[model samples]
Target: MTRLPTPAPEGDPRDGGRRLMLVEALAGRWGWSPRADGDLGKTVWAECAL
Candidate 1:
């Protein structure tokens, strides 16, 4: 089983910044595109088969 570290408080003096950096990087990697970026609009629909 994988164990994730407990979330740190927003103002932890020692590790908060480090934790934020990790989270931000992961979010960018997996998150959806911002509405204003690229060619995507408010909705996108597609169909395909793998």
Candidate 2:
């Protein structure tokens, strides 16, 4: 059997606006909590409610 590796996501714009857009989309659609800024001192989390 053989498997193929996933393709990398398209590159974001150098200004990083596109990267943040992608993150927000995924978090919103998946019910995932966005990452915290280090100053928040919170644990990483993922959650969804059925």
Candidate 3:
């Protein structure tokens, strides 16, 4: 059986920022619709598939 790496915990500061940066980078790369706040909010409310 193959096992996947576990996702980062929600409360870790470094992991939290890293995930947000990745999301913003992907969004910029693909030209997706921007968030209503004009930026990726500190807390992501949804999971977007790249």
Clash count, one per candidate = 0, 0, 0
- Candidate 2: misplaced stretches above 4 Å? 1-14, 28-50
By lDDT, the better pick of 1 and 2 is: 1
Shift of residue 16 alpha carbon in model 3, Å = 1.4
What value of lDDT does candidate 3 attain over all alpha carbons? Answer: 0.45
Model 2 lDDT tens row, 1-50: 42322223568334433444444445533222333664522232333334
Local accuracy of candidate 3 as per-residue lDDT tens digits, 1-50:
52322345567665434464455556533222335686743324444565
- What C-alpha lDDT do the candidate models reach, one value each? 0.41, 0.37, 0.45
Assess the local accuracy of residue 30 in candidate 2 as a C-alpha lDDT between 0 and 100. 27
How should the candidates be ordered by lDDT, best one leading? 3, 1, 2
Q: Give the distance in Å from residue 38's predicted Cα in candidate 3 to where it truly belongs.
A: 23
Whole-model alpha-carbon lDDT for candidate 2: 0.37
Candidates by TM-score, descending order:
3, 2, 1
Regions more than 4 Å wrong, model 1: 1-13, 29-50
Q: Flag regions of model 3 displaced more than 4 Å.
A: 1-15, 28-50
- What local lDDT score does residue 40 receive in model 3, on the 0 to 100 scale? 49
Error of 2 at 8 (Å): 20
